[model samples]
Target: MRQTWRWFGPKDLTSIDDITQAGAEGVVSALHHVPNGVVWTKEEIAKRHSEISTRKDGSASGLTWDVVESLPVTEDMKKQKGDWREHIANYKISMRNLADSGIETICYNFMPVLDWTRTDLRWQVAHGGSCMRFDIADFAAFDIHILKRPGAPADFTNAIADEAGRRFEAMSEDDKKQLARNVTMGLPGSTESMSLEDVQAHLNEYGAISRDQLRQHFIHFLEEVVPTAEDLGLRLCCHPDDPPFALLGLPRIMSTAEDYKYILDAVDSPANGMTFCTGSLGARPDNDLPAIVEQFAEKIHFLHLRNVKRDNDDIMGSFYEAEHLGGDTDMVAVIAAVIKEERRRKAAGRKDWQIPMRPDHGQDILDDLGRRAQPGYPTIGRMKGLAELRGVFTALEHGAFGLK
Candidate 1:
């Protein structure tokens, strides 16, 4: 496994020096300042490469931008609407520029409107630490009472609806407004910032689109872009939906393992791959983490190894981010499966044997309580996760899992 860290940009509170201190071998970042539909010029790509390799005093940092966390697939491209063809052309050009600049992995997603929805940004855990949480009742309150979507009532059970009603009544005016902002945080550097009214308008537009339609749209997208990626020697990894379930009546086609197999089969190319995110897929109890890892190990190009403790028995359960080894996921088993896959790849003499992974999210503990870094990208929190995961890899390779 190749250890990497997700860095926002030059303006990020956590600097490249900080990533170096964490012992990460590479940096995962994007040209966040550029708009969604715009083409990333070779000059722009080279400038970011220069920044990652050089320091403030113009000396060498020895770190390279190995993977792009995303290359921002816009709404028009997903829906095949206004300027969709033009956007596809631009996306291919960006892939060529990135390949020419020596970056191989690019991660993206097909989620509409929101990137990741969380009802509470700071939900206190049993310990003194706080983690990002998604509460079903609070989300229901926002959907039914706050956002007032057309069919919000039919999605959840009667019990969930009743609880949501009570929660909304208990919340003060300030709490409701803040809850609205938290859910719409979207991508880190999205070109368009939306409001509550804008969210409703977007949902209204998707009323006619079903889950099957969305899946077809995504396949249509890959049909155009995957060939370009294969030609450019780039591996395009699609990130799973954050919660891996339907929310606010939007279709979530890329949530389950079956969804991944369907898309990979549709594009049937070496360039098309999956970003195996344990945190999102683990939010559902039915998703067996280790089994899923081995089942699609060949297609997984990037990894996001974080755990979440689910609250309810159903698919739409509430979940909160947990410490690296403290969560319900069997971290040791998951890492063992990853190791087994790498050994298999090495025996086959594949060039891309070592997979790139980063600690996804962490609890706000100790010094990270008041940090200026992005929420979930805290320096101390992620360093702790990286150390814990590295220990897992070390132990497994040294006979802990009998690999030695």
Candidate 2:
């Protein structure tokens, strides 16, 4: 397994120097300033590459832009509306440019309007530490009362609806506004921030689209772009849905293992791949992380190794970002499975075997308290997560448990 860090840009509180200090081997980043569906030029790509590797003093930082967290697929591309064909062509051009720049892995998602939704951006935890949480009641309150999304009431059960109603009734005006803002915060460190009105418009745009139609749209997208990635020896890895379930009546197609199987089989190429995000897939109770890793070992090009503590036993419940080893996932077992897959790949003599794994979000703690960092992305907190993950990896690689 290869270690990487996700850096937003020069504007992020954590700099490339900080990432180097954290002991990460590579950087996962994107050109966030550029608008969606616009072709990323070779000049811009080379500029970001230099920014990742070169220092102010003309020294080498020993880091490269190894993986793109996303090359954003525009709202129009997903909906196939208004210049989507042009957007698809632009996406192809961007992929070719990125490959020419030597970045092999590309991550993207198809979760309609919102990239990732949470009801609380900074829910207080023990010892004054905080992390993001997805409270079902709070989300239902936002959907049923705040955004007033049509058919949202019917989407929730009667008991959930009643609780959401009470939650909405009990909130102050400011609290209601804050809930709306937090839930629709969209992808952090990106250009696509949405408002409550924007949410309504997007939901209206996807009004009658079902799961089948959305999956077909994704397949069509792959049909157009996956071949380009294949010809260029690029890995087009799709990230699973954040919550891995439907929300606000929007169709969620890429949220499950079977969903991935459908897409991989549809394209049947190594270039068409998956970003095995344990935190996102572990949100669903049925998504066994180790088994999924073992089964999809051939196609997983990148890994986001984080865990979440589920509030309920069911799939559709609340969850919070837990410590690296303290959530529903068996961290050691998952790492073991990953190591096993790497060994198998090495035995088979596959060139692209070292999967780039990053220590994803962490709970706020210690000096991370007052930094006001990007919601879940605290400086010391993520360093702590990286340390813990490195410990597990060391134990596994050194044969601490006899597997190695």
Candidate 3:
């Protein structure tokens, strides 16, 4: 795997020096300044690339902006409501501009309501700082109590509702605000935040669209976009739905392996691929991580490797900063599967054999708390994660080559 670090462009507090120091060879970023539904011009892409390339040696040696963490889909695109054809056309133009500049891998998600939900952005880790995580109870608390969207209580049982109510009532004002920010504030790589009115308006657009409707819309999107991607030699990797479940009255389409199969089957093109995110899929215990990797080995273009600790029954737990080998994911087996796929690609003489992989989310530690870095993208924590993954990959490669 070719290791990459996600840099949120020039506005990010963590400079290119910080990324290089973290031992990443490539940068995953997007033109965050550009609004959703607008075409990203070639000049905009070049400007951002040149800005990042301005390092101490007047060159970004190990840094190449090869992956876009996201090019957000407007609400119109998701709902397939009004002017979406125009939006999709603009998105295709952006992909073409990005590809013209040598970006081959593009990662995007089609989740309806939220991109990724976290009850706490500063959820404290026992040893030091914090990492982002979704607490089911906390989310329930928000749905049924804080935001208090109608019909929210029905989503949970009486016992769960009661617990959520209690948690909501007991929370301090600051805590409530934090939870709101955690949920409503769109993270970097995604678009801007929405007012309550904006969210309600967005929901109104999707009122007629069920999960099936959304799925059809996504399939239609792929049908239109994938051919353009293929022409540009860009692999369009769709990120799995985070939390892998429906929430806040929105539909989730890409939650399971079957969902992925449906997507590829809809487009039936190599350009339509998956960005295999372990933490996202691992949230649902039913998903056998290794099995999915082995099954979809041919279509996986990118990976976000992280682990989550799921408790028994319905009780969910915090995300631990587990070592690459220590997490719930059978990473050794996962790596072995990836290696098998790489070997297969090599035998076929494919150029993009070494997939670009990143340590997904990291625990916020050390000086990261005070720093102005993007949320959940702390410098030291990700540096540690990248280092650990690299060590694991090295050992696996050596073992494959029979190196003592």
In terms of lDDT, the best-performing candidate is: 2
Per-residue lDDT, model 1, residue 87, is 89
Over 4 Å off, model 3: 187-192, 313-325, 399-404
Candidate 2 lDDT, 155-206, residue by residue in tens: 8888999999999999999999899888878764653357888888888989
TM-score for each of the candidates: 0.97, 0.97, 0.94
On a 0 to 100 scale, what is the lDDT of residue 368 in model 2? 77
For residues 1-404, write the lDDT of model 3, one tens digit per residue.
Answer: 88888888776777888887788888888888888889999999998788766685677555788789898887789888788999999999999999989899999999876677777677676676777777777888877777877788887778778888899889999988778767776544643555656666766677678989899999989889999998999999999987787788888889899999998998998898999998888878788899999999989999998777664335233343344455677876787788789888988998988899998777677888888366677888778888877876787778556222
- Per-model lDDT: 0.87, 0.89, 0.80
Q: Ten-residue segment with the worst summed lDDT in candidate 3?
A: 312-321
Runs in model 2 deviating more than 4 A are 56-58, 399-401
Model 2: lowest-lDDT 10 consecutive positions: 185-194
Q: Which residue pairs collide in model 2, if any?
A: none
lDDT of 3: 0.80
Least accurate 10 contiguous residues by lDDT in model 1: 185-194
